[model samples]
Target: MSDHTINLNKAHFTISAPDIRKLPNDDGIEVAFAGRSNAGKSSALNTLTRQKSLARTSKTPGRTQLINVFEVEEGMRLVDLPGYGFAKVPLEMKKKWQKALGEYLEKRESLQGLVVLMDIRHPLKDLDHQLIEWAVESELPVLALLTKADKLSQGKASAQVLDVKKKLKPLGGDIKVYGFSSLKRTGFDQATQVISQWFSQNIENTEESDEVAE
Candidate 1:
Protein backbone atom coordinates (compact mmCIF):
# COMPACT_ATOMS: atom_id res chain seq x y z
CA MET A 1 0.00 0.00 0.00
CA SER A 2 1.21 3.48 -0.78
CA ASP A 3 1.28 5.79 2.23
CA HIS A 4 0.05 9.07 0.77
CA THR A 5 -0.07 10.69 4.18
CA ILE A 6 3.68 11.19 4.05
CA ASN A 7 3.32 13.83 1.35
CA LEU A 8 -0.41 14.48 1.45
CA ASN A 9 -1.59 16.03 4.68
CA LYS A 10 -4.68 13.83 4.72
CA ALA A 11 -6.12 10.90 2.73
CA HIS A 12 -8.87 8.44 3.63
CA PHE A 13 -11.46 6.14 2.10
CA THR A 14 -14.79 7.94 1.94
CA ILE A 15 -17.96 6.45 0.41
CA SER A 16 -19.41 5.10 -2.77
CA ALA A 17 -22.31 6.54 -4.79
CA PRO A 18 -24.62 4.68 -7.11
CA ASP A 19 -24.85 7.85 -9.14
CA ILE A 20 -23.80 11.48 -8.92
CA ARG A 21 -27.26 12.33 -7.65
CA LYS A 22 -26.58 10.11 -4.66
CA LEU A 23 -23.19 11.64 -3.84
CA PRO A 24 -23.08 13.34 -0.45
CA ASN A 25 -23.56 17.08 -0.79
CA ASP A 26 -21.63 18.58 2.09
CA ASP A 27 -20.08 20.77 -0.64
CA GLY A 28 -16.50 19.54 -0.86
CA ILE A 29 -14.38 19.82 -4.00
CA GLU A 30 -14.11 16.59 -5.99
CA VAL A 31 -11.48 15.30 -8.40
CA ALA A 32 -12.62 12.35 -10.52
CA PHE A 33 -10.73 9.58 -12.35
CA ALA A 34 -12.30 7.98 -15.43
CA GLY A 35 -11.17 5.74 -18.30
CA ARG A 36 -11.75 2.56 -20.22
CA SER A 37 -11.16 -0.71 -18.43
CA ASN A 38 -7.51 -1.91 -18.47
CA ALA A 39 -6.41 1.65 -19.11
CA GLY A 40 -4.68 1.66 -15.71
CA LYS A 41 -6.94 4.28 -14.14
CA SER A 42 -6.92 2.59 -10.77
CA SER A 43 -3.22 1.89 -10.85
CA ALA A 44 -2.37 5.48 -11.70
CA LEU A 45 -4.72 6.74 -9.01
CA ASN A 46 -3.29 4.41 -6.38
CA THR A 47 0.21 5.37 -7.40
CA LEU A 48 -0.45 9.08 -7.43
CA THR A 49 -2.37 9.15 -4.19
CA ARG A 50 -0.05 6.57 -2.63
CA GLN A 51 -2.99 4.28 -1.89
CA LYS A 52 -2.18 0.68 -2.75
CA SER A 53 -5.70 -0.68 -3.21
CA LEU A 54 -7.70 2.47 -3.32
CA ALA A 55 -9.53 1.97 -6.63
CA ARG A 56 -9.24 -1.78 -7.21
CA THR A 57 -7.46 -2.49 -10.51
CA SER A 58 -7.91 -5.85 -12.19
CA LYS A 59 -7.76 -7.62 -15.54
CA THR A 60 -11.51 -7.97 -15.35
CA PRO A 61 -13.17 -5.08 -17.13
CA GLY A 62 -16.13 -3.18 -15.71
CA ARG A 63 -15.36 -4.21 -12.15
CA THR A 64 -16.32 -0.88 -10.66
CA GLN A 65 -20.07 -0.49 -10.25
CA LEU A 66 -20.28 2.80 -8.42
CA ILE A 67 -18.63 6.16 -7.99
CA ASN A 68 -16.09 5.33 -5.32
CA VAL A 69 -15.16 8.43 -3.34
CA PHE A 70 -12.03 9.05 -1.29
CA GLU A 71 -11.53 11.89 1.09
CA VAL A 72 -8.03 13.15 0.40
CA GLU A 73 -8.44 15.96 2.90
CA GLU A 74 -11.00 17.76 5.01
CA GLY A 75 -12.17 19.82 2.06
CA MET A 76 -11.49 17.64 -0.97
CA ARG A 77 -12.46 14.23 -2.32
CA LEU A 78 -11.36 11.89 -5.13
CA VAL A 79 -14.00 10.08 -7.16
CA ASP A 80 -13.28 6.86 -9.03
CA LEU A 81 -15.82 6.43 -11.79
CA PRO A 82 -16.80 3.20 -13.53
CA GLY A 83 -14.97 2.40 -16.76
CA TYR A 84 -16.84 2.78 -20.06
CA GLY A 85 -17.15 0.57 -23.17
CA PHE A 86 -16.47 -2.88 -21.76
CA ALA A 87 -17.57 -4.97 -24.75
CA LYS A 88 -17.19 -8.21 -22.83
CA VAL A 89 -19.77 -7.13 -20.30
CA PRO A 90 -23.45 -7.96 -20.59
CA LEU A 91 -25.77 -5.40 -22.18
CA GLU A 92 -27.41 -4.59 -18.87
CA MET A 93 -24.03 -4.10 -17.28
CA LYS A 94 -22.72 -1.99 -20.12
CA LYS A 95 -25.77 0.20 -19.80
CA LYS A 96 -25.22 0.52 -16.10
CA TRP A 97 -21.61 1.67 -16.48
CA GLN A 98 -22.58 4.10 -19.17
CA LYS A 99 -25.32 5.48 -16.98
CA ALA A 100 -23.06 5.71 -13.97
CA LEU A 101 -20.35 7.46 -15.95
CA GLY A 102 -22.70 9.83 -17.71
CA GLU A 103 -24.65 10.81 -14.61
CA TYR A 104 -21.50 11.49 -12.63
CA LEU A 105 -19.89 13.59 -15.32
CA GLU A 106 -23.02 15.58 -15.99
CA LYS A 107 -24.46 15.94 -12.50
CA ARG A 108 -21.67 15.90 -9.95
CA GLU A 109 -21.55 19.54 -8.92
CA SER A 110 -18.59 19.13 -6.63
CA LEU A 111 -16.60 17.54 -9.42
CA GLN A 112 -13.87 20.09 -10.08
CA GLY A 113 -11.71 18.17 -12.52
CA LEU A 114 -11.42 14.88 -14.35
CA VAL A 115 -8.36 12.66 -14.87
CA VAL A 116 -8.91 10.63 -18.02
CA LEU A 117 -6.51 7.68 -18.26
CA MET A 118 -5.56 5.74 -21.37
CA ASP A 119 -3.08 2.99 -22.17
CA ILE A 120 0.08 4.30 -23.83
CA ARG A 121 -0.47 2.41 -27.07
CA HIS A 122 -4.15 3.29 -27.19
CA PRO A 123 -4.33 6.80 -25.93
CA LEU A 124 -7.58 8.09 -27.39
CA LYS A 125 -10.07 5.47 -28.37
CA ASP A 126 -13.75 6.09 -29.03
CA LEU A 127 -14.62 5.73 -25.36
CA ASP A 128 -11.89 8.19 -24.47
CA HIS A 129 -13.19 10.68 -27.00
CA GLN A 130 -16.74 10.38 -25.69
CA LEU A 131 -15.56 11.03 -22.17
CA ILE A 132 -13.68 14.08 -23.39
CA GLU A 133 -16.76 15.22 -25.22
CA TRP A 134 -18.80 14.85 -22.07
CA ALA A 135 -16.29 16.93 -20.13
CA VAL A 136 -16.27 19.58 -22.81
CA GLU A 137 -20.03 19.65 -23.07
CA SER A 138 -20.32 19.90 -19.30
CA GLU A 139 -17.63 22.56 -19.13
CA LEU A 140 -15.44 20.42 -16.90
CA PRO A 141 -11.66 20.69 -16.63
CA VAL A 142 -9.91 17.51 -17.65
CA LEU A 143 -6.30 16.36 -17.35
CA ALA A 144 -5.93 13.70 -20.03
CA LEU A 145 -3.35 11.04 -19.17
CA LEU A 146 -1.71 8.16 -21.03
CA THR A 147 -1.08 5.35 -18.55
CA LYS A 148 1.49 2.53 -18.66
CA ALA A 149 4.16 4.74 -20.15
CA ASP A 150 6.83 2.48 -18.74
CA LYS A 151 5.73 -0.21 -21.15
CA LEU A 152 7.11 2.00 -23.90
CA SER A 153 10.70 3.03 -24.42
CA GLN A 154 11.61 6.67 -23.70
CA GLY A 155 11.45 7.53 -27.39
CA LYS A 156 8.12 5.73 -27.77
CA ALA A 157 6.75 7.49 -24.68
CA SER A 158 7.45 10.87 -26.21
CA ALA A 159 5.84 9.77 -29.45
CA GLN A 160 2.75 8.56 -27.61
CA VAL A 161 2.42 11.94 -25.94
CA LEU A 162 2.54 13.60 -29.31
CA ASP A 163 -0.06 11.24 -30.71
CA VAL A 164 -2.32 11.96 -27.78
CA LYS A 165 -1.87 15.70 -28.18
CA LYS A 166 -2.71 15.47 -31.85
CA LYS A 167 -5.89 13.63 -31.08
CA LEU A 168 -6.76 16.16 -28.40
CA LYS A 169 -6.42 19.17 -30.71
CA PRO A 170 -9.93 18.73 -32.10
CA LEU A 171 -11.17 18.69 -28.53
CA GLY A 172 -9.52 22.08 -27.89
CA GLY A 173 -6.29 23.26 -26.29
CA ASP A 174 -7.94 24.21 -23.02
CA ILE A 175 -7.49 20.62 -21.86
CA LYS A 176 -4.10 19.40 -20.60
CA VAL A 177 -2.58 16.00 -21.44
CA TYR A 178 0.35 13.91 -20.14
CA GLY A 179 1.75 10.40 -19.99
CA PHE A 180 1.92 8.38 -16.73
CA SER A 181 3.31 5.07 -15.52
CA SER A 182 2.62 3.52 -12.16
CA LEU A 183 5.28 0.82 -12.46
CA LYS A 184 8.17 3.08 -13.41
CA ARG A 185 6.86 5.99 -11.33
CA THR A 186 7.18 8.19 -14.38
CA GLY A 187 5.13 11.39 -14.73
CA PHE A 188 4.51 11.57 -10.96
CA ASP A 189 5.76 15.11 -10.70
CA GLN A 190 3.83 16.24 -13.77
CA ALA A 191 0.70 14.54 -12.54
CA THR A 192 1.21 16.02 -9.09
CA GLN A 193 1.59 19.48 -10.55
CA VAL A 194 -1.71 19.11 -12.41
CA ILE A 195 -3.54 17.97 -9.28
CA SER A 196 -1.97 20.75 -7.27
CA GLN A 197 -3.24 23.26 -9.81
CA TRP A 198 -6.75 21.95 -9.34
CA PHE A 199 -6.27 21.98 -5.56
CA SER A 200 -5.50 25.66 -5.67
CA GLN A 201 -8.58 26.34 -7.78
CA ASN A 202 -10.66 24.22 -5.44
CA ILE A 203 -9.32 26.06 -2.43
CA GLU A 204 -10.28 29.34 -3.99
CA ASN A 205 -13.82 28.10 -4.57
CA THR A 206 -14.08 26.76 -1.02
CA GLU A 207 -12.86 30.02 0.44
CA GLU A 208 -15.45 31.91 -1.51
CA SER A 209 -18.14 29.53 -0.32
CA ASP A 210 -17.00 29.91 3.27
CA GLU A 211 -17.11 33.69 3.01
CA VAL A 212 -20.64 33.53 1.61
CA ALA A 213 -21.62 31.32 4.55
CA GLU A 214 -20.26 33.86 7.00
Candidate 2:
Protein backbone atom coordinates (compact mmCIF):
# COMPACT_ATOMS: atom_id res chain seq x y z
CA MET A 1 0.00 0.00 0.00
CA SER A 2 1.12 3.53 -0.68
CA ASP A 3 2.12 5.91 2.11
CA HIS A 4 -0.83 8.10 1.20
CA THR A 5 -3.14 5.16 1.76
CA ILE A 6 -2.31 4.48 5.43
CA ASN A 7 -2.40 8.19 6.18
CA LEU A 8 -0.35 7.70 9.35
CA ASN A 9 0.28 11.44 9.26
CA LYS A 10 -3.29 11.74 10.42
CA ALA A 11 -2.57 9.54 13.41
CA HIS A 12 -3.23 11.05 16.81
CA PHE A 13 -3.18 9.92 20.41
CA THR A 14 -6.46 8.41 21.51
CA ILE A 15 -5.79 7.57 25.15
CA SER A 16 -3.39 6.19 27.67
CA ALA A 17 -4.85 3.35 29.68
CA PRO A 18 -2.93 1.81 32.52
CA ASP A 19 -4.77 -1.47 32.14
CA ILE A 20 -6.03 -3.45 29.17
CA ARG A 21 -9.63 -3.45 30.46
CA LYS A 22 -9.58 0.33 30.12
CA LEU A 23 -8.41 0.33 26.48
CA PRO A 24 -10.82 1.25 23.73
CA ASN A 25 -13.15 -1.59 22.82
CA ASP A 26 -11.42 -4.49 21.13
CA ASP A 27 -13.58 -4.16 18.08
CA GLY A 28 -11.02 -3.72 15.31
CA ILE A 29 -7.45 -4.51 14.30
CA GLU A 30 -4.55 -3.05 16.27
CA VAL A 31 -0.79 -3.45 16.32
CA ALA A 32 1.34 -3.36 19.47
CA PHE A 33 4.86 -1.95 19.70
CA ALA A 34 7.00 -3.81 22.26
CA GLY A 35 10.62 -3.34 23.18
CA ARG A 36 13.12 -3.08 25.96
CA SER A 37 13.21 0.29 27.69
CA ASN A 38 15.42 2.77 25.79
CA ALA A 39 15.20 0.74 22.61
CA GLY A 40 13.66 3.72 20.73
CA LYS A 41 10.08 2.45 20.57
CA SER A 42 8.62 5.92 21.01
CA SER A 43 10.99 7.46 18.50
CA ALA A 44 10.01 4.79 15.99
CA LEU A 45 6.29 5.35 16.47
CA ASN A 46 6.80 9.07 16.08
CA THR A 47 8.83 8.61 12.91
CA LEU A 48 6.48 6.08 11.32
CA THR A 49 3.47 8.34 11.79
CA ARG A 50 5.43 11.45 10.82
CA GLN A 51 4.23 13.03 14.02
CA LYS A 52 7.02 14.12 16.32
CA SER A 53 5.12 13.82 19.54
CA LEU A 54 2.60 11.12 18.70
CA ALA A 55 4.56 8.87 21.06
CA ARG A 56 6.63 10.57 23.67
CA THR A 57 10.42 10.18 23.53
CA SER A 58 12.16 10.41 26.85
CA LYS A 59 15.79 10.48 27.90
CA THR A 60 14.95 8.24 30.83
CA PRO A 61 14.26 4.60 30.23
CA GLY A 62 10.89 3.16 31.27
CA ARG A 63 9.30 6.56 31.36
CA THR A 64 6.29 5.26 29.46
CA GLN A 65 4.76 3.25 32.23
CA LEU A 66 1.33 2.85 30.71
CA ILE A 67 -0.24 1.44 27.59
CA ASN A 68 -0.60 4.29 25.08
CA VAL A 69 -3.12 4.05 22.26
CA PHE A 70 -3.07 6.03 19.03
CA GLU A 71 -5.66 6.14 16.32
CA VAL A 72 -4.24 5.41 12.90
CA GLU A 73 -7.68 5.75 11.42
CA GLU A 74 -11.16 4.66 12.48
CA GLY A 75 -11.06 1.11 13.85
CA MET A 76 -7.28 0.99 13.46
CA ARG A 77 -5.15 1.55 16.55
CA LEU A 78 -1.45 1.58 17.29
CA VAL A 79 -0.60 0.49 20.80
CA ASP A 80 2.62 1.51 22.51
CA LEU A 81 3.17 -1.03 25.24
CA PRO A 82 5.23 -0.03 28.26
CA GLY A 83 8.85 -0.95 27.76
CA TYR A 84 10.37 -3.66 29.93
CA GLY A 85 13.80 -4.38 31.52
CA PHE A 86 14.82 -1.14 33.17
CA ALA A 87 17.41 -1.74 35.85
CA LYS A 88 15.92 0.49 38.50
CA VAL A 89 12.43 -0.96 38.25
CA PRO A 90 11.52 -2.98 41.31
CA LEU A 91 11.39 -6.71 40.75
CA GLU A 92 7.80 -6.91 41.95
CA MET A 93 6.75 -4.10 39.61
CA LYS A 94 8.63 -5.66 36.74
CA LYS A 95 6.83 -8.93 37.30
CA LYS A 96 3.50 -7.16 37.21
CA TRP A 97 4.38 -5.50 33.94
CA GLN A 98 5.57 -8.77 32.51
CA LYS A 99 2.39 -10.56 33.44
CA ALA A 100 0.31 -7.75 32.06
CA LEU A 101 2.28 -7.70 28.85
CA GLY A 102 2.02 -11.43 28.39
CA GLU A 103 -1.70 -11.35 28.99
CA TYR A 104 -2.13 -8.46 26.58
CA LEU A 105 -0.12 -10.18 23.89
CA GLU A 106 -1.80 -13.55 24.31
CA LYS A 107 -5.37 -12.56 24.99
CA ARG A 108 -6.07 -9.25 23.30
CA GLU A 109 -8.47 -10.10 20.49
CA SER A 110 -7.85 -6.93 18.49
CA LEU A 111 -4.08 -7.23 18.46
CA GLN A 112 -3.14 -8.20 14.91
CA GLY A 113 0.63 -8.13 15.23
CA LEU A 114 3.64 -6.76 17.08
CA VAL A 115 6.53 -4.44 16.26
CA VAL A 116 9.47 -5.49 18.44
CA LEU A 117 12.29 -2.99 18.75
CA MET A 118 15.85 -3.75 19.81
CA ASP A 119 18.87 -1.51 20.04
CA ILE A 120 21.25 -2.23 17.18
CA ARG A 121 24.15 -2.73 19.55
CA HIS A 122 22.19 -4.96 21.93
CA PRO A 123 19.88 -7.12 19.92
CA LEU A 124 18.07 -10.11 21.40
CA LYS A 125 18.54 -9.57 25.09
CA ASP A 126 16.79 -11.96 27.46
CA LEU A 127 13.57 -10.00 27.63
CA ASP A 128 13.60 -9.49 23.88
CA HIS A 129 13.67 -13.24 23.39
CA GLN A 130 10.79 -13.62 25.82
CA LEU A 131 8.72 -11.10 23.88
CA ILE A 132 9.39 -12.92 20.62
CA GLU A 133 8.46 -16.18 22.29
CA TRP A 134 5.16 -14.72 23.43
CA ALA A 135 4.41 -13.60 19.89
CA VAL A 136 5.28 -17.01 18.57
CA GLU A 137 3.06 -18.73 21.09
CA SER A 138 0.25 -16.36 20.29
CA GLU A 139 0.80 -16.96 16.59
CA LEU A 140 1.02 -13.21 16.05
CA PRO A 141 3.04 -11.73 13.22
CA VAL A 142 6.09 -9.69 14.21
CA LEU A 143 8.23 -7.03 12.55
CA ALA A 144 11.45 -6.74 14.52
CA LEU A 145 13.25 -3.43 14.07
CA LEU A 146 16.90 -3.13 14.95
CA THR A 147 16.68 0.46 16.10
CA LYS A 148 19.61 2.92 16.24
CA ALA A 149 21.09 1.70 13.02
CA ASP A 150 22.57 5.13 12.45
CA LYS A 151 24.97 4.48 15.31
CA LEU A 152 26.74 1.86 13.21
CA SER A 153 28.42 1.90 9.84
CA GLN A 154 26.42 0.69 6.86
CA GLY A 155 28.36 -2.57 6.71
CA LYS A 156 27.98 -3.17 10.45
CA ALA A 157 24.27 -2.40 10.36
CA SER A 158 23.68 -4.74 7.45
CA ALA A 159 25.58 -7.47 9.20
CA GLN A 160 23.61 -6.92 12.39
CA VAL A 161 20.38 -7.18 10.45
CA LEU A 162 21.42 -10.52 9.06
CA ASP A 163 22.66 -11.70 12.43
CA VAL A 164 19.44 -10.66 14.11
CA LYS A 165 17.41 -12.43 11.47
CA LYS A 166 19.52 -15.51 11.91
CA LYS A 167 19.14 -15.44 15.67
CA LEU A 168 15.36 -15.04 15.36
CA LYS A 169 15.11 -18.20 13.28
CA PRO A 170 15.07 -20.36 16.39
CA LEU A 171 11.86 -18.76 17.70
CA GLY A 172 10.18 -19.41 14.34
CA GLY A 173 7.04 -17.38 14.01
CA ASP A 174 5.99 -15.08 11.18
CA ILE A 175 8.82 -12.59 11.81
CA LYS A 176 10.67 -10.11 9.63
CA VAL A 177 13.73 -8.35 11.06
CA TYR A 178 15.01 -5.14 9.51
CA GLY A 179 17.67 -2.51 10.19
CA PHE A 180 15.94 0.73 11.17
CA SER A 181 17.15 4.17 12.21
CA SER A 182 14.57 6.51 13.68
CA LEU A 183 16.97 9.45 13.34
CA LYS A 184 17.54 9.03 9.61
CA ARG A 185 14.02 7.67 8.97
CA THR A 186 15.60 4.74 7.25
CA GLY A 187 13.36 1.71 6.66
CA PHE A 188 10.26 3.77 7.40
CA ASP A 189 8.39 2.68 4.32
CA GLN A 190 9.31 -0.96 4.73
CA ALA A 191 8.25 -1.00 8.38
CA THR A 192 4.98 0.73 7.63
CA GLN A 193 4.33 -1.69 4.79
CA VAL A 194 4.52 -4.62 7.18
CA ILE A 195 2.08 -2.94 9.55
CA SER A 196 -0.24 -2.12 6.65
CA GLN A 197 -0.11 -5.71 5.50
CA TRP A 198 -1.17 -6.89 8.95
CA PHE A 199 -4.20 -4.63 8.80
CA SER A 200 -5.06 -5.89 5.33
CA GLN A 201 -4.65 -9.49 6.33
CA ASN A 202 -6.94 -9.04 9.31
CA ILE A 203 -9.62 -7.51 7.10
CA GLU A 204 -9.33 -10.36 4.65
CA ASN A 205 -9.59 -12.94 7.39
CA THR A 206 -12.63 -11.29 8.90
CA GLU A 207 -14.32 -11.22 5.50
CA GLU A 208 -13.54 -14.86 4.87
CA SER A 209 -14.91 -15.85 8.24
CA ASP A 210 -18.08 -13.91 7.55
CA GLU A 211 -18.46 -15.62 4.20
CA VAL A 212 -18.01 -19.02 5.79
CA ALA A 213 -20.62 -18.23 8.41
CA GLU A 214 -23.04 -17.11 5.72
Candidate 3:
Protein backbone atom coordinates (compact mmCIF):
# COMPACT_ATOMS: atom_id res chain seq x y z
CA MET A 1 0.00 0.00 0.00
CA SER A 2 1.12 3.56 -0.62
CA ASP A 3 2.20 5.73 2.30
CA HIS A 4 -1.09 7.59 2.60
CA THR A 5 -1.16 10.04 5.48
CA ILE A 6 -4.34 11.48 6.97
CA ASN A 7 -4.28 15.14 7.92
CA LEU A 8 -5.93 15.01 11.32
CA ASN A 9 -5.45 18.74 11.69
CA LYS A 10 -8.11 19.18 9.05
CA ALA A 11 -10.71 17.56 11.24
CA HIS A 12 -13.97 19.46 11.75
CA PHE A 13 -16.95 18.77 13.96
CA THR A 14 -19.68 16.74 12.32
CA ILE A 15 -22.20 15.82 14.97
CA SER A 16 -22.65 15.05 18.65
CA ALA A 17 -25.06 12.18 18.65
CA PRO A 18 -26.64 11.09 21.91
CA ASP A 19 -26.52 7.50 20.74
CA ILE A 20 -25.36 5.35 17.85
CA ARG A 21 -28.72 5.40 16.10
CA LYS A 22 -28.42 9.17 15.58
CA LEU A 23 -24.89 9.01 14.14
CA PRO A 24 -24.02 9.30 10.48
CA ASN A 25 -24.54 6.26 8.31
CA ASP A 26 -22.26 3.39 9.36
CA ASP A 27 -19.89 3.74 6.39
CA GLY A 28 -16.22 4.62 5.79
CA ILE A 29 -13.50 4.27 8.46
CA GLU A 30 -13.89 5.50 12.02
CA VAL A 31 -11.34 5.51 14.81
CA ALA A 32 -12.89 5.93 18.24
CA PHE A 33 -11.19 7.51 21.25
CA ALA A 34 -12.38 6.31 24.65
CA GLY A 35 -11.25 6.74 28.21
CA ARG A 36 -12.35 7.31 31.77
CA SER A 37 -13.50 10.74 32.80
CA ASN A 38 -10.60 13.08 33.70
CA ALA A 39 -8.25 11.04 31.53
CA GLY A 40 -7.37 14.18 29.48
CA LYS A 41 -8.97 12.60 26.46
CA SER A 42 -10.13 15.91 25.05
CA SER A 43 -6.72 17.45 25.49
CA ALA A 44 -5.12 14.56 23.68
CA LEU A 45 -7.60 14.88 20.86
CA ASN A 46 -7.04 18.61 20.54
CA THR A 47 -3.32 18.04 20.43
CA LEU A 48 -3.64 15.34 17.80
CA THR A 49 -5.86 17.44 15.56
CA ARG A 50 -4.08 20.71 16.35
CA GLN A 51 -7.46 22.22 17.09
CA LYS A 52 -7.91 23.77 20.50
CA SER A 53 -11.67 23.41 20.80
CA LEU A 54 -12.33 20.47 18.50
CA ALA A 55 -13.06 17.99 21.27
CA ARG A 56 -14.12 20.43 24.00
CA THR A 57 -12.04 19.96 27.14
CA SER A 58 -14.00 20.73 30.25
CA LYS A 59 -12.95 21.58 33.79
CA THR A 60 -15.58 19.18 35.12
CA PRO A 61 -15.40 15.54 34.32
CA GLY A 62 -18.25 13.85 32.46
CA ARG A 63 -19.02 16.99 30.52
CA THR A 64 -18.79 15.03 27.31
CA GLN A 65 -22.01 13.03 27.46
CA LEU A 66 -22.40 12.40 23.78
CA ILE A 67 -20.71 10.54 20.96
CA ASN A 68 -18.79 13.40 19.27
CA VAL A 69 -17.83 12.95 15.65
CA PHE A 70 -15.21 14.84 13.60
CA GLU A 71 -14.51 14.21 10.00
CA VAL A 72 -10.91 14.42 8.83
CA GLU A 73 -11.92 13.97 5.22
CA GLU A 74 -14.71 12.56 3.17
CA GLY A 75 -14.45 8.96 4.33
CA MET A 76 -12.24 9.29 7.43
CA ARG A 77 -13.56 10.24 10.85
CA LEU A 78 -12.49 10.47 14.46
CA VAL A 79 -14.88 9.77 17.30
CA ASP A 80 -14.74 11.01 20.86
CA LEU A 81 -16.75 8.51 22.84
CA PRO A 82 -18.51 9.35 26.09
CA GLY A 83 -16.26 9.26 29.13
CA TYR A 84 -16.76 6.44 31.64
CA GLY A 85 -16.08 6.14 35.41
CA PHE A 86 -17.11 9.59 36.58
CA ALA A 87 -18.66 9.09 39.99
CA LYS A 88 -20.03 12.61 40.31
CA VAL A 89 -22.67 12.01 37.68
CA PRO A 90 -26.07 10.63 38.57
CA LEU A 91 -26.46 6.86 38.33
CA GLU A 92 -29.07 7.08 35.62
CA MET A 93 -26.96 9.40 33.47
CA LYS A 94 -23.95 7.16 33.93
CA LYS A 95 -26.00 4.16 32.85
CA LYS A 96 -27.21 6.02 29.81
CA TRP A 97 -23.71 6.93 28.72
CA GLN A 98 -22.51 3.40 29.30
CA LYS A 99 -25.34 2.03 27.22
CA ALA A 100 -24.49 4.36 24.35
CA LEU A 101 -20.82 3.47 24.51
CA GLY A 102 -21.54 -0.24 24.60
CA GLU A 103 -23.93 -0.08 21.69
CA TYR A 104 -21.47 1.86 19.54
CA LEU A 105 -18.64 -0.58 20.15
CA GLU A 106 -20.77 -3.63 19.46
CA LYS A 107 -22.69 -2.36 16.47
CA ARG A 108 -20.72 0.31 14.56
CA GLU A 109 -19.68 -1.32 11.32
CA SER A 110 -17.38 1.56 10.33
CA LEU A 111 -15.33 1.33 13.49
CA GLN A 112 -11.89 0.35 12.22
CA GLY A 113 -9.78 1.13 15.27
CA LEU A 114 -9.90 2.20 18.91
CA VAL A 115 -7.70 4.69 20.77
CA VAL A 116 -7.99 4.04 24.52
CA LEU A 117 -6.50 6.87 26.60
CA MET A 118 -5.54 6.46 30.26
CA ASP A 119 -3.85 8.63 32.81
CA ILE A 120 -0.29 7.37 32.94
CA ARG A 121 -0.19 7.46 36.74
CA HIS A 122 -3.35 5.37 37.06
CA PRO A 123 -3.35 3.19 34.00
CA LEU A 124 -5.85 0.56 33.10
CA LYS A 125 -8.76 0.59 35.49
CA ASP A 126 -11.34 -2.22 35.37
CA LEU A 127 -13.38 -0.40 32.75
CA ASP A 128 -10.28 0.24 30.67
CA HIS A 129 -9.41 -3.43 30.71
CA GLN A 130 -12.95 -4.36 29.77
CA LEU A 131 -12.90 -1.98 26.81
CA ILE A 132 -9.58 -3.29 25.59
CA GLU A 133 -10.72 -6.87 25.93
CA TRP A 134 -13.87 -6.16 23.97
CA ALA A 135 -11.85 -4.55 21.14
CA VAL A 136 -9.47 -7.49 21.08
CA GLU A 137 -12.35 -9.92 20.96
CA SER A 138 -13.87 -7.97 18.09
CA GLU A 139 -10.52 -8.14 16.24
CA LEU A 140 -10.19 -4.36 16.23
CA PRO A 141 -6.80 -2.70 16.41
CA VAL A 142 -6.13 -0.56 19.50
CA LEU A 143 -3.70 2.26 20.22
CA ALA A 144 -3.44 2.57 23.97
CA LEU A 145 -2.29 6.04 24.98
CA LEU A 146 -0.90 6.53 28.46
CA THR A 147 -1.95 10.15 28.67
CA LYS A 148 -0.44 12.85 30.94
CA ALA A 149 3.03 11.41 30.66
CA ASP A 150 4.45 14.82 31.47
CA LYS A 151 3.21 14.43 35.02
CA LEU A 152 5.79 11.69 35.62
CA SER A 153 9.55 11.65 35.29
CA GLN A 154 10.78 10.30 31.99
CA GLY A 155 12.29 7.21 33.60
CA LYS A 156 9.14 6.51 35.58
CA ALA A 157 6.93 7.11 32.54
CA SER A 158 9.03 4.80 30.39
CA ALA A 159 8.83 2.12 33.05
CA GLN A 160 5.07 2.50 33.26
CA VAL A 161 4.72 2.08 29.52
CA LEU A 162 6.77 -1.11 29.68
CA ASP A 163 4.71 -2.46 32.57
CA VAL A 164 1.46 -1.78 30.75
CA LYS A 165 2.85 -3.40 27.60
CA LYS A 166 3.96 -6.45 29.57
CA LYS A 167 0.54 -6.84 31.09
CA LEU A 168 -1.29 -6.41 27.79
CA LYS A 169 1.06 -8.58 25.75
CA PRO A 170 -0.84 -11.70 26.63
CA LEU A 171 -3.95 -10.46 24.89
CA GLY A 172 -2.18 -11.02 21.55
CA GLY A 173 -3.97 -8.40 19.49
CA ASP A 174 -2.90 -5.40 17.42
CA ILE A 175 -2.48 -3.12 20.42
CA LYS A 176 0.23 -0.45 20.58
CA VAL A 177 1.00 1.35 23.84
CA TYR A 178 2.75 4.73 24.13
CA GLY A 179 3.29 7.40 26.73
CA PHE A 180 1.37 10.47 25.51
CA SER A 181 1.16 14.01 26.83
CA SER A 182 -1.00 16.64 25.21
CA LEU A 183 0.81 19.32 27.18
CA LYS A 184 4.31 18.21 26.35
CA ARG A 185 3.39 16.78 22.96
CA THR A 186 4.91 13.49 24.04
CA GLY A 187 4.26 10.61 21.68
CA PHE A 188 2.42 12.97 19.35
CA ASP A 189 4.04 11.76 16.17
CA GLN A 190 3.76 8.13 17.14
CA ALA A 191 0.10 8.42 18.03
CA THR A 192 -0.79 10.36 14.88
CA GLN A 193 1.14 7.96 12.67
CA VAL A 194 -0.59 4.94 14.17
CA ILE A 195 -4.05 6.44 13.72
CA SER A 196 -3.26 7.62 10.21
CA GLN A 197 -1.98 4.19 9.29
CA TRP A 198 -5.25 2.67 10.46
CA PHE A 199 -7.19 4.86 8.05
CA SER A 200 -4.72 4.25 5.24
CA GLN A 201 -4.73 0.52 5.74
CA ASN A 202 -8.50 0.35 5.79
CA ILE A 203 -8.74 2.28 2.53
CA GLU A 204 -6.19 0.01 0.89
CA ASN A 205 -7.96 -3.09 2.11
CA THR A 206 -11.30 -1.87 0.83
CA GLU A 207 -9.80 -0.98 -2.52
CA GLU A 208 -8.22 -4.41 -2.85
CA SER A 209 -11.50 -6.13 -2.06
CA ASP A 210 -13.31 -4.03 -4.64
CA GLU A 211 -10.71 -4.90 -7.24
CA VAL A 212 -11.12 -8.58 -6.46
CA ALA A 213 -14.89 -8.28 -6.96
CA GLU A 214 -14.43 -6.69 -10.38
TM-score for each candidate, following the candidate numbering: 0.89, 0.93, 0.98
Q: Please identify which of the two predictions, 1 or 2, would achieve the higher lDDT against the true structure.
A: 2
TM-score of 3: 0.98
Enumerate residue pairs that collide in model 1: none
lDDT of 2: 0.88
**Model 3 spans > 4 angstroms off:** none
TM-score of 1: 0.89
What tens-digit string does per-residue lDDT give for candidate 1 at 109-150? 788888998888887888898888778877788898888888
Please write out the lDDT profile of model 3 over residues 1-214, one tens digit for every residue: 6577789999999999999999999999999999999999999999999999998988998999999999999989999999999999999999999999999999999999999999999998999999999999999999999999999999999999999999998888999999999999999999999999999999999989999999
TM-score-sorted candidate list, best first: 3, 2, 1
Instruction: Give lDDT per model, in order.
Output: 0.79, 0.88, 0.96
Instruction: For candidate 3, give the lDDT of residue 162.
Output: 100
**Clashing pairs counted in every model:** 0, 0, 0
Ranking by lDDT: 3, 2, 1
